[model samples]
Target: MNTTRTLIAAAIATVGTAAHAVDLKAGEWDIAIGGIVNAYYTHTSCSGSQAVGGAALATKGLGCGGTDGRTVIGNGLLPNALTTTAKTRQEGLDISATLMIGAAVASGDAISNNNNNVDVRQGFVTFGNADMGTVKLGRDYGLFGSSAILGDMTLLGAGAPVAATQRNRVTLGHIGSGYTYLGTYGQIAYSLPTSGGFSATVALMSPVDAGTAIGRNEPQLQALATARFGGGKAWLGVKRQKFEGTGGAASFTMNAAEVGASFSAGALGFAANVQSGKGLGVLTDGDSGNRKQTNVLLQATWQATAKTKFGLNWGESRLKDGAATDLRSNTNVTAGLYYGLTRSVTLVAELSRTTSKPVTGEQARMNGFALGGIVFF
Candidate 1:
């Protein structure tokens, strides 16, 4: 069995699952490497008239430009990634550093030389031991909504594909519809050593603009508390930040909270989460105004056989402005079948439906099907 040494593996562990990372020892330092690579072919069909003009709620609209269906071959919600880590104990303190690089498999068009999309998602260092809380410095995923996304079944496959023209893009996977993306952030954070099956984390993260206001004056604060028990776990997280008025713009604050839980019994798994916030946009953190937003996610999975699993999920995000009648929502549902072809490879097939509903306009709806495979190592 492999130890949980890689950051990616640690992420998966949050949801009561783990991945095997190949490890090596070089003298005094221990090294490990692991990641995932996946690709999918997706077809999206649209129905109902699209809303006129640009509506913030229009969001992805299934990336459909018209009623005609579109086909795309590209990466899913998760891009191909390669994570490397090195750790050592010095002077009674354990230290480690990790760097994760990810790229889209679709590359680009058939041009002679098309550029690919590559990014460094995680670059951080940690120093501490179980006796003392660990401190993380640099860039990594935020705590808020981290569990929600990690526990999502679509994390292993495609949920919603947008724009067939941009093959290099990754699928949505309920990002804008279900939950705000817990984007990686530059920050200083501390994780308390686990005690009594409970642990917590707090971070002061790099700031960003909140709608029209600027947040350069202060840092974003994020915290999370998690509890683990037999065959189950639960978590709660919060995020808060203040933005200053710039160029006569009004000042505003962004605050968000989320709660989630996951558990398994007799090869059957269930998960659910809820998020509500102000000034938290449907997709990203910042949007104009201190609008109220809420998100809900529900999922269930069953291990039908040693080599096969089935999953179904529903999620929605709603944004409401000050106006009583101005409300917009995005919703998506996905049904997936996963088969383990090998110890380190899995095949996936998924069908998904997405809808965008505005207070006054035609609803934009899309249906999609995806087939893909993912390998972990």
Candidate 2:
């Protein structure tokens, strides 16, 4: 084509791409960038003198100090993060990719060399259709408890108080305390088309590698189905896996299940979930064993005003017959408020109490209060 024809074709291509995405445009691709910056000042009082050995504990010489009270700067439940996305419309389908990373905000490390600095939170590609289904591959959140945490009121603030010295720039919203951790993992997942407010998902994931004479021979299988009714949504998920090695030891098997729901009536919202498993790793690391793990979570929120909200949440996680030769459990309760200072800025405050206990060890209790702000762009 001639120079004039080429220029006109380029202009037309730009206009055609504008209907798909926003932020910035480059060649045939649309670029979008966004992020959240959050920081909190926290005061925690610990009640325990026992020092078993874990990096996360409340002893006179460990984490935050027991009975002496410690104050520090940390992150809320939502860490300071940056996300960049690119997408294109092809054959009536949305083909997209996303990259999410966390920043070290409160580490006081000017070089961002801290342990929690700049870790990849998500890197995934997806293809979806409004009438058809969706397929995703790469690293992303798991399906079992995604809704429970997404609907949690504490997602905007600190919920469970972890070890201060070992804090990772962000608080846990009942992750290790109330539910089996739903970590990000590599998987090929497919979501059935949504129909009448219902949908289902099936995934094949890399299996856990329990150390034995040999490695397991199969990938883990997971499935989840959700239904929406009235003002709430409910979900059920199940997972099954087996780790076998030849030699003298027996094969290890894991069976896990979870159920959860979220509902809203007027300005009041509630959410709850429960999970149990035999031989499922507490953090879903794919380590096969004969241990038992269980967890429960509950939350309630109220929108007091257009820009002001109040919320309370609780959760518990337990491990019985664990490979460690003892039982362990954690329970946490949190109450907080969120006030929107502007359309893209928010003020958050929270108070939380958590207890950690082991079968034959001293129990530890921690009380913490946090004040923070989050800016989104």
Judged by lDDT, which candidate is best? 1
**Model 1, 139: alpha-carbon shift in Å?**
0.5
Model 2 global lDDT (CA atoms, 0 to 1): 0.67
Q: Which predicted model would earn the best TM-score?
A: 1
**Model 2, 366: alpha-carbon shift in Å?**
1.1
TM-scores vs. true structure, each candidate: 0.90, 0.82
1-377: candidate 2 lDDT, tens digit per residue = 01001111222221121112238887767888767677777777777635332323333333354445777677776666667788888889878887878765555355545664566767888888867788888876677666556666666666764544325556676766666656666778888887888889888776656566233577778788889899888999888778775566667677889999988899888899998887655444434255677878998888888788888988887777432324376678889888888766678889988776665667777787888876666
**Candidate 2: deviation at residue 248, Å?**
9.9
> For candidate 1, lDDT tens digit of each residue in 133-251?
89899888888878888788888788766644236657777787788888788989998888888989899999977546878878999999989899999999999998787778887
